[model samples]
Target: MSILPLLIIVPFTFIILALFIHHVRIKNALSLILGLTNFALAFYILKIVHNAGMLKTQMGSWPAPYGITLVADRFSAFMIFISAIVFLAVTLYSIQSIDKERLKNNYFLFTYGILMGVNGSFIAGDIFNLYVWFEVMLMSSFILISFGGEKAQLEGSIKYLILNLISSFFFVAGIGILYGKMGSLNLADLALKFSRIGDFPSLFEPSLILLLVGFAIKGALFPFFFWLPASYHTPPPAVSALFAGLLTKVGIYSLIRIYTLFLHHYDYFWNPIILWMGILSMVIGVITATSQFDFRKILSFHIISQVGYVIIGLAFYTISGLAAAIFFLGHNMLSKTNAFLVAGWVHRERNTLSLKDLGDMFNKHTLWGILFFISAFSLAGLPPLSGFAGKYLIIKAGIESNQIIVAMVALFVGLFTLFSMTKIWIEVFWKNTKNEKNDSEQRIKSNGLPYRYMITASIILALSIIVMGVWAKPIAEFCETAATDLLNNQKYINFVLG
Candidate 1:
């Protein structure tokens, strides 16, 4: 039996246990244990993939292209590992940050369901199976988004649900059309079939377009991104962090997986469309974020801009481009989540996320302030942080691929990002608004929540950002290898189809 399945199994096991347990502390402990176990399992799987190149298993012992196949190559393994880190961090943070009412209502169960879906999506070897995993993720996320049942949460959940359901419709419709034409849902088999159909490639273009729209909407690119900022700010910061860290990235991961497997064959059509989407998303996302007054709203909008970096890297279609995209994706997950975790702390202490009301946070808690500084600056692409390395590689890849204009746009976005981050820093940390409550009163308000858990979680992610930046070379090298594995689609096809 391969250990790869344990990633899914462990979370499912916990989900079942959560249903029978009425004790909140026990549930929290179980969730943490599940998180730690899954993290270990994901790390072990990554090591296995590193040593073995790829790992595969067929449910019920059915052979390739017939059975439900789960395969982990370099790229999938890397994503799973990073997602595990974010999940564990969020799980630990949720102990204190999530309200007890939500906790009693099976928050951990829904969260574990999300983990199962995310892990399953990464390892799924066929297109239809991928869709199933997507539904699983969305179902869990929808529940989490609406868990509070507050008016704002209900409004946000409605928007979130309708948009994602539309995305799923697009995705499944594409899958149906594709299977009708190709007579296969296995990704490897479809790739093989498509490789042989070079003459009438236009026949499948409609299906591809549908799929692209689905992925783009889910990834929150360009015009399809409005749903993100509208809903993300409405969730608890912990829930928002989980969604920010994992949900959108899965959509991007699927896009990259399909692109390498077959979509690249239509690069002539996709190149310009993808390039401009990236550019517009960068400009529009930052431009909108600059006007936001809420802490999470600004971060939510920046998620769009950061995702643009990844998409543009894909547009370059070079090894360096893909490597940078991969690295940037990982960096954004950690930094963005950490930023949200810090926001959780702010919300906990001040009971509001309005920047106008926030001031002297640094004086109140210098360590939390520093944590926010590290994450915010990292997102702004500051030196010696992961964002700098990611942006540098993306720009370098763009220039190397003769897309100088795109590279320049990326540089400018970094500056705009810096501006937004600085605004947050000065407003939230440096300025001393007259509305400041007495320190003792603020402490008493926050004292009910176990602030230590929130701080610990933020520190964990903050350190990961710093470490990723300081160790950029080795991680970047690993991403290069993952990128190579992705670009060399025949290797993936061979492993899965054999």
Candidate 2:
């Protein structure tokens, strides 16, 4: 009856129903219906939270310490709402993009499974449940990434699987250690026990480190990010776009959750490490992106770099800093999704993502060129766009925190991001090539625009980026409120388990 259970149940039910449907259209329709219903429920919950502050639902009549608890605070509800919007957009885009024979019903099942996992993660109150949700999400992602069984897809999926499994092992080990020390898997219970124990500092430090490392691997932070670029470029563009937009952010969401809740006292130990890694990730990702010729490869690398900005904000540990991080998280999701969608369109048109092979596309498809330009400029943090607003807030936070060096690094990284975007722009949009000679010579070429559905979905995301930038005040306020809830663990635990 509660919205929390529906978040997981609807998707799970649809996935099971998909197994019995023989008609592709019926399956697709069913999936879309489920996605829309889930999206609606997420908004309904958001409205309830907005009016009533927070919402919690315990499974059955059992209390928190004995039964599963689902909690939707301002922060979790906000993530679920955004994630629902993204699922709707991606599902709509996939209607025309995916091949029936290659992906079929299994695609929808995996997609829905992922949605369930993401929703579960957003609401889960137990550490063990969080781990379960993470594995569910990861398994679905593995299947989705390797859907068509292409050589590239298989290779990427394999690498991703192995790395993630290793990360999962570490995660489980950390959870086991925490349970051994505290005798409870419930997050709030552990926090209480941790605060009361006299020798908590010594025992807590290693467990926290292991937990942070596990999350860092998932988030694709520096030294653990090689799998991201290697695997992300192999999937179909829509899948790539969805993964780029949502997956890493889940890791980020977990990091924010862990640090602010159980490990608040460990801030001094981890913040500097996060700060340095953020800087290194930004510099390295941009540099690697500039060196790549494949459009998707470049975009994949940029995902790593942009995540750096989010980490930097959290590292500052100020209200403005966390708020800026949240703003950037939303902004980056929109911009990156649009970028990958545009890249997919370009690849569809030219049948190649190589910059050397595709050129002067702007001359033929002006609309796509313009759209790509807007998205790219926004991604580069141009003024009056969503990206700029986030960057400004993060930089301002850095200044306020007296982290002058990190602020300078962030500014420099923004310039490099611009340079990488320009590189892609000149190569794909403006460069003249002999290969285009015959195509250009034709007097009348039919538009043959890449899938209209995809374009429409991408345009919606681009518009959101612009709108979020133009009217940032309310969103900023929301981020601040969410950050306050996140940092104040007592509020979160009481809301979930009371």
Candidate 3:
């Protein structure tokens, strides 16, 4: 009766169907249908979790630490629901945004593959399975990143592959060491075991550190984040949007899940490390982003900066802090992806993402200009948008937790973010360009492409950002419940083990 499996099943089914369907129209139609179906299913699953608190299913008649388990508490259910929304929006955009050759090459196939991996990771009940899902994501993403086989795509995919593979090695190695020490892979069972250890487990901390390094790299945290900016812009805008929305977030989710289950025991050792990494990631990411002119690259670096906000929130380790982290994560997913979606439109119109080459976009496409404004300012933490609410919650939590320095840093990062976003707005949308190559003919040629799909997709996500902002109170309260559930680790352990 558990709907958890359906999240994985629906995407896997789409992948299979995509294999047989050679027609591009059929594939796009199927992808949209499957995306809608999955979104509805995710919404229902979240509703059930809200009513029932938690849901779990054991596979193949096995039980507890011996089985393939899927579990969803409020946090995971909420992630699944948000991911479904982003995935659906991207699918709609890709219908018009992706080129025909890439469509022929099974772009949607790999995209659905990512959806499967993301859904699986959210519900994975064991560390080993979590790693497996990560690999699933990496493989599909590797192919997508290089699908066009452009020189830049090839180069970017190489860096992405090498760095993520290293992440995999560290993660699987940590899993091995943990299993050797603890004798179980199931998360709840592992939590039960870790909680029973009386003294601070020095031996276990190394394994946890190894795991953290892996996650930090995967999540594009400070010093481990070079791969994201180097590569995220090389892909088509739709692909970049997908990666921005869901992939790094899985790594962040893993960090939160593991910290709740195991790492929190040694707060003394981990808190400062997490806290400072967040501080550096915030300052460094925003500063670097300000130097970028490429549209997607700027947004890519902001991904790092925004993730740091979530990290600092987690470091605070209070119910408010975790809730803010969760809220921010969801808000960033929508806003960041929508920014990239608008960038796709920019590319389609101008054939380049260089801000210097893009100007007077507001004059040509007024609605897209508005769309970019909504998403960009929201990301800058401006008022009456989801990003503002998210950042407000995080800073308030930081102050309430007496982390004044970190709160101030977060506030200033928002200012830098606003500056960079304004730069993009001014250079790309407001200022008129002097480039003669982009004449009226060129604009008409690019504008001739079917735009309803792209416009509809951008509107969907833009509306989501507005709704989350206007209705911030109820959403933040739900996030608080989810955070409380996360902090209360015993609830998770008991549900899975029982």
Candidate 4:
């Protein structure tokens, strides 16, 4: 529990250190070292959670309902650990990929700032603190997104800012109402209170709904996901991959956290809505992605499509379903980040990601193309990959639950996902282009970032996808354990309050 605070403080300390470092190499070195350290700490926390149950610490030595609380359950620890892995990979890649001008401009600080908020959100034990952490993440992201001050970046940042502001507004308003009625902001305390309260008021439903909208926007669910496609591709790939890996997942984490803890008893009220949201996000996100020619844009939309699958698990409100959701969420984070990193490499080398203008990745950069193939096919749910395992679990659970429509949608979504992947594969990797320059000549003419660092970063994540796929039983077991914990709110409440 004491270690939980250090998760935030570690990155925060690096942010302070980064402020004083002007040299790009030193900043990059510091960032990479700290990122690895953060991952180690999170791994330690995960082991602790797996061995023990949930761990809780009260800030300022105040107990439970009166103090700021940080709690780590299996789910949160898993998320923090995965977040660390991506942070380290991105940091290493950014050393070479991020512009030197941006590196000198406290880029590492802003990056660390975002990590702090993400870690904070995962461990926060209450809604109000979660809201605070969301703001921290949003503020850092705003700066990072607009750092280059490119016209496209600024424009994208505006859409991101406006939607997030609305989200924050809804979030705070809901928090206000939650505290007003419950007289407490502690998660376990609220769970106990709501459980014991028996009947809920008419207004209580709206408060929860408001919180849902706020998280929906942050998580990029349909009808609220337009901001994502508009803005995500505008940033540098490192920033885009970080955002892809952690930002929306945090929102999804909150959704799972809130629903499993405080909102489970009210399932009748929210389950229908959850199903519709999941279905629409899956269908709309994938179909829209097919129309996009830009590499990053397609991946950004796929984020929405994949998020829908997780939501469907929640909609089932079963342990098996939630386990699948958690597993799928983890898989998607790695796959999506790697995909964007591949796009980054392409955009760097080919000077474009427009499908019509790009080709011959296999001919020129066979290794990088192979990396993309692993990530893309895994994302498309090919056999014996991480995506396949996750989808198999979800569809099986959906079928057993008699959610035939949900199961069918999951299957169809996978097919379209494959189609989307094939489109990118054919256009970017296989198709031959006219008037193509030789590799050496291309390198001579290009002002692109060097390939070694980026390839190393992508390979680290790519290997993870393969390892998780081949050695999936243990991971699946862990997800099942985490899912059980989430469903058993009494256990969570007892651990936090005791």
1-498: candidate 2 lDDT, tens digit per residue? 677788999899998998988888887788789868988999998888876778888888679877878888887888888888778778877776777774464688888888989999988878889999999999999989999889999999999999988888888899988778778887777766665763444634666778888888888988889899999989888899889888888888888887777676666667788888888888898889888988999999999999999999988988899899988988888889889888988876666898888788888777878778877888899978889999999999999999989999889989988998998899999987676556654323335434677777777777888888888888888888888777777877776667
Q: What TM-score does each of the candidates earn?
A: 0.98, 0.95, 0.99, 0.98
Q: Model 3 TM-score?
A: 0.99
Q: lDDT of each model, Cα atoms only?
A: 0.92, 0.84, 0.94, 0.90
How do all the candidates rank in terms of lDDT, highest first?
3, 1, 4, 2
lDDT of 3 by residue, 1-498 (tens): 667888888899889999999999999999999889999999999999998999999977699899989999999999999999999999999999998989888889999999999999999999999999999999999999999889999999999999999999999999999899899999999999989995663744768888999999999999799899999999899999999999999999999999988899888778889999888999999999999998998999999999999999999999999999999999999999999999998998889999888898898789999999999999999989999999999999999999998999999999999999999999999998786565687777965675999999999999999999999999999999999999999999999999
Report backbone clashes per prediction.
0, 0, 0, 0
> After TM-score superposition, what is the CA distance of residue 309 in candidate 3 from its true location, in Å?
0.3
lDDT per residue, candidate 4, 159-193, as tens digits? 99999899999988988988888999998999999
Q: Against the true structure, candidate 2 has what lDDT?
A: 0.84
Clash-forming residue pairs, model 1: none
Task: Name model 4 segments beyond 4 Å from true.
Answer: 437-440, 446-450
Q: How accurate locally is residue 24 in candidate 2, as Cα lDDT from 0 to 100?
A: 80
lDDT of 1 by residue, 274-339 (tens): 889988999999999999999999999999999999999999999999999999999999999999
lDDT of 2 at 296: 92
**Candidate 1 or 2, higher lDDT?**
1
